[model samples]
Target: MSKIGVVLLNMGGPDSLSAVEPFLYNLFSDHDIIEIPRLIQKPVARLIAKLRAEKTKHYYEVMGGKSPQREQTEQQAKALQNVLGENYKVVVAMRYWHPFTEEALRELFTEDISKIVLLPMYPQYSKTTTGSSFNEFERVFKRFPQVPVIRIISYHNHPAYIRAMVENIKEHLQSWESYFFLFTAHSLPVQVIKRGDPYKDQTEETVKLIMEHFPEVSYALGYQSKIGPVKWLEPFTDKLIEELIKSGVKRLALIPVSFVCEHSETLYELDVQYKSLAESLGVESFVRIPTLKDHPSFIEALRQLVISSLQ
Candidate 1:
């Protein structure tokens, strides 16, 4: 008869343009994300953040001067809380920005909870995403070892999750026959994959699972949002768009398979940048299947994961 705590983990974004630099600093400072030696990480992070802040701020400005991810994740938390009812308290623990994992743990420790569930917003597992968040959690959790923790690592192939994505995609499609599906995920450096990260494989598996429902539909997987000049998971999404357009594929449907919420990557990169690129290449129609943000099925999927973890 004790309360359960559910903490949703995500890579938080700046709430406003002013917060952009610090957010970037926090992100780059994380050793799990930007691999730098402990001695010079902060200095390098500061320099990188300073260099990128203006351009990054412009990206956010184009998307209404802030990232919608925090709001979307909070709404998802509320929805999940409602689904779980009074017995569970759901909160978000963002890795890089405000409402950070430290803050989330502080709030949950104050609650009369019996156990805590650490659920990453990412469906696919990657050291840079879920692993980074978990590392932060473990650092903060040292303060409250008495409260048992249950970690739901990637649920990439979870039936409920796959069903939610499939359902969302189905609802958005006018006719599956006319559109060429492109499954695009946030790209990681190729070095990360070589280091034994399961991200690439898991992402591919998620796409494979979702595509099972649309056997006849033409689809290809691509990677987007690569940082710096490092070789990332290929083929790059922008290049893929060009390839498809040149190949006589005029109508395309882009699916952000790795993301569960709308953020800069989806809103600006996919919606504006990629859309513009596709249009410039004479793509007749470019549709982006929306991320499953608090969709009823997605909420149900979260609820099921929590319930199963409890048992």
Candidate 2:
């Protein structure tokens, strides 16, 4: 039997504080991110990375000098591998850091795999996430086009994924009373949307589907992780939290909707930074629903996605 390769894609984070700068340089250098001419973007990306490296290092320092994304992603990859059986090989491909897509592709090319399944870890399709990863994958896989590639673009509304998210949320919340739900997604620059990115819409769809499972739960949607002066999707999660607090909402539940696994954004950004913000705003309870990393239903969803793609 020919080996089936399953490639899981994600925006890889720096493994340690020292690698953060170069990782940022790689990230900002990507056309999908900076969206400028190569010559100009390269130097600009370097400058930005150099300027931000110190501050970014502090973030990693607080999180124990590294990001947990690679570990968490490996956990998901391992789970998928187990479910897919011995004949299947699962690869974890990160966009900007170690074990990059190129490395994964090279490794797979040497293997006895007959076909490749590209399953992006991002549940929603976005030019920045899945699109970027696909673009890179295509560029590398050009060398082995004979090995057919099946891509699963997005599974934002997949039943198993939605169920896993709902279950994770229910498992986290100690009580449903007096708490309002906030479905938070990572924010993208407004210009990205103007350029016809469907990320926001797909994220909304995910929210709507999850909302269906909680008709009695009062919930709202917002964006997070905005950087720089650029106008990002609004109302921002922090501002929305403030609004909820001013409106006499004492308890708040936050769900990192776009993220399927815990990373710096969830741990440092939402848990540490946003938690502090919520407390300062007089929020009595700030509950952040965990990401769906290695959840049985989520792994099942990945299996289904691969099965459908192979067909």
Candidate 3:
């Protein structure tokens, strides 16, 4: 049997208490992820990273200074390996966190694997997010002649993926009259959109498909997690909530479209902060559908992505 590999891609989190600075530095250093020219990129990255580290450290502190994504990614990888059986080996490569992409790729390369299918943890296709990681993987993989081939799973209007999201949302659906379906995703700077990044558009496509699944529901799209002081995708999540309140909306159903798993942005920002803000604004109820974590349908989606790429 020809040896094949599935290298999972993620925006990694800090592995330990002390690694936070370097981890954030590595993340902010990526021009694809945080594009500022070399003139001030280093100084700017260092300054923001230090500030973010302090604030972000609190979320990690709550989770014991670790992201459950590592454990979850491992579990998902093992399950996928089982589904793929002995035909392929599975591994994870995080962009900034522990079990870095370099480490994962090095290990897989040693397994004599040729050609890899990059199953990014993100469902939707975004140039900055998924594409950045994919590009990096390509750059690194090119160094090894034996590992010349790579594939990226663009994403997720797949039936299995849709089914997984729908099922998860269904479980959390609260009985309310005319709920606002807030499709939330991580926001990118407006400048990037002019460069044709496609993150916002990709997110819109996912929300459209999801709202299609529920024709009876009235929905709205909003962007979240805008870093620094620059314009982002409009109708920000916080502003949208306030707007909805003015429009006499009392109930909302929020979904984090850009994320595949629950993290600080999802748990703290959305679940804790946004949820409270909604309550304060007289929004009757706000329910967030959980991320697809070890869900059977999502597992099948990952397997299908890999197997199809092989074909």
Candidate 4:
């Protein structure tokens, strides 16, 4: 029997404080991310990375000098490997950091795999996330044209995925009488949406599906992680939280809808920064639900998706 290889794609975080600057450089250097001319973008990206390195390093330090994204992704990989058994080889391909997508593909080419499946951990489709990684994979896979490949770009509204999210949110909401559901996803530049990127659409759909599962709960969707001066997706999470406080929402639950695993964004930004802000705003019962991170339901979702794709 021909072996099957599965490649999991994600935007990786810096493994150490010292690697933060270079990680940022790589992130901004990608044309799919910044969309600037290569000649001018490289130098500008370098400057931005250097200027932001210290501040970015502080966030990493707060999260214990490294990002748990790689570790969480590894756990997911192992779980999938266990389910798929001996014939399938699972590989993690992070876009911006160690175990990079290109590097991972190069290494996998040496294995006895006959076919490859590209499954990005991102549930929603985004040019900066899934598109960027897919582009890199295609570029590298060109070197080995003999190997067949299949790709699962997005599974945002799959029933099992929605179920996993519902379960996680309910777990955090236990015993809370009245609370506002703050569904947050990483913001993208407004220009990207204008260009017809389906990210905002898909993200909204995912939130909508999850919202449908619990009609009794009041919820609002917002975008987070806005960088630079350009406008991003509307009703930013921080601003929305403030608004919710003014509206007499005391108890709040923040759900990271875009991320499936904990990273700097969730660990530091949401847990630390947002929690502090919620406390300052006098909001009681500020709870941030954990990312999907190796949840059995999520793993089963992956298994089902892969098995269907193979057929």
Candidate 5:
């Protein structure tokens, strides 16, 4: 029987402090992430990576000197493979680090694979994330074009995915009425949205679908992980937190709406940095609902998506 290859695409993080600079370089070098003239892109990436290495490394150090994204993604792949049985081979392709799209393609090409499914781990479609990964795959797939491929662009409002999000939020809710829910996603530049990226709209739709489970709960959407000075999707997560506190919102529950796994954004930025900011602002109870990392419902959601794509 011919095996079906399932590739999970994600933006990988440095495995250790030593890999930080190169990882950032790889990230910035991608035109999809940072638009720059092709002739000077590498130089610019190198310079930015060098300047940001120390600060980025410091964040990694606090989180045990590495990122858990690779491991978490691998676990998810394993779960997916088990669910898929022997007829399917599930692999992970990290965009900016090791186990890249090329590596994943090579691995699957070695198998008796008849078809491939490109599944970006991102729920919301963004040029910076899913578009970048798909573009990378296209670039690398040139050498290995034997197998047919199907791509899942986005599942922001897929029923199974929406169920998973609702279930995750329900698992973490304590005082649903008292705690104000803040759904936070990775911020993108306003320019990107202006250029017609569907990320912002899809993220809002995901929030809407998840909120159907709790009509009585008060919730708002915010963006996190803003970089540089460019205007990004707002209100920013940190700013929103402060606003909530000033408005007498004593309790807040932060939801990682766009992320499926815990990474620097969720672990350090949201858990450590934003948590500190909230406490300092005199918020009584601040809770960050965990990402849907291999949650049974989320795994089931992936399984359903993969199965549907194959049909």
Candidate 6:
């Protein structure tokens, strides 16, 4: 059989509080996620993971102590397989959580797979997310003598992706009026920006395209979920919201553009905490738009990406 396999990659979150430490350990140990020098990588990684796990668990607990990443990725994988026709098999592979990259790679070994494709759900090319997943994947593949020859579908920032995002915004915004079109993506530390990571720039470009597509979006593009004192992209979403309230903007429509599937960040951090903060600041209305999962354009984008990679 001329086997063709697609590995759908993502940064996985813990499913429970007990899993938090190990989950974060995997995330922190990756040089792509945290650049602790090789000399003290293990020790520093353990320490950071242990520390961050506590706070991260709180975020998860607030949103029912888990994230929908695994299920969402599985759904996407099934959908992609359908779109790619019955021949292409796609596997959900995560960096830190369940259906781990190692496990996914092992699954490939059992199959008659020859040509494989790597697909990161992340639209933005970030060393911290897609790069990190690929780095781990390479590590796993090196263990095998004849690793299935693979081609990678790099970030597909095509017009279809932009249209999917814009369509979601337009559909959701139809019900609201006089609200700020707040575009929020996952935040990367400022150090990454200084180190020449293109995540920030790519995000900004997406914002530009969305704006071009929808001229009515008086949106402010900002980053969210920055941890620690290390400077992150600003104006940060929370700070931006507060600033907007101060500037007399009473209504807001926030969308987590970086996240295509709902997660703790979107559920609790944005929905609950940010909503509470906005309410306290005397803002009358604050709503968060859901991610565009199973949206026709998004699935079509994935299908196009897979087909393009195959050829």
Best by lDDT: 1
Q: Which runs in model 2 stand beyond 4 Å of their true positions?
A: none
Please state the error at residue 283 of candidate 2 in Å.
Answer: 1.6
| Pairs in clash, predicted candidate 2 | none
Ranked by lDDT from best down, the candidates are 1, 5, 4, 2, 6, 3
Tens digit of per-residue lDDT, candidate 1, span 1-311:
67899999999999999999999999999999888798999999999999999999999999999999999999999999999999988889999998998788778767788999999999999999999999999998887747888999999999999999999998997887789999999999999999999999999999999989999889999999888877889999999999999999988999999999998899999999999999999998899999999999999999999999988
lDDT of 2 by residue, 261-283 (tens): 88888989898998998999899
Off by over 4 Å in 1: none
TM-score of 6: 0.93
> What is the C-alpha local distance difference test score of candidate 4?
0.90
Winner by lDDT between candidate 3 and candidate 2: 2
lDDT of 2 at 115: 88
Weakest lDDT window of 10 consecutive positions for candidate 6 = 147-156
Please write out the lDDT profile of model 5 over residues 1-311, one tens digit for every residue. Answer: 78999999999999999999999999999999888799999999999999999999999998999999999998999999988899999999999998988999888877889999998899999999999999999999999957789999999999999998988887887767788999999999999999999999999999998888888888999999888877888999899999989999999999999899989999999999999999999999999999998888888999999999988
- List CA RMSD, all candidates: 1.0, 1.2, 2.0, 1.2, 0.9, 1.9
> What do the candidate models score in CA lDDT, each in turn?
0.93, 0.90, 0.80, 0.90, 0.92, 0.81
Query: TM-score, each model?
Result: 0.98, 0.97, 0.92, 0.97, 0.98, 0.93
Q: Scored by Cα lDDT, where does model 2 land?
A: 0.90
Q: lDDT for model 1, please.
A: 0.93
Q: Which ten residues in a row are the worst by lDDT in model 5?
A: 169-178
As for model 2, its CA RMSD to the true structure in angstroms is: 1.2
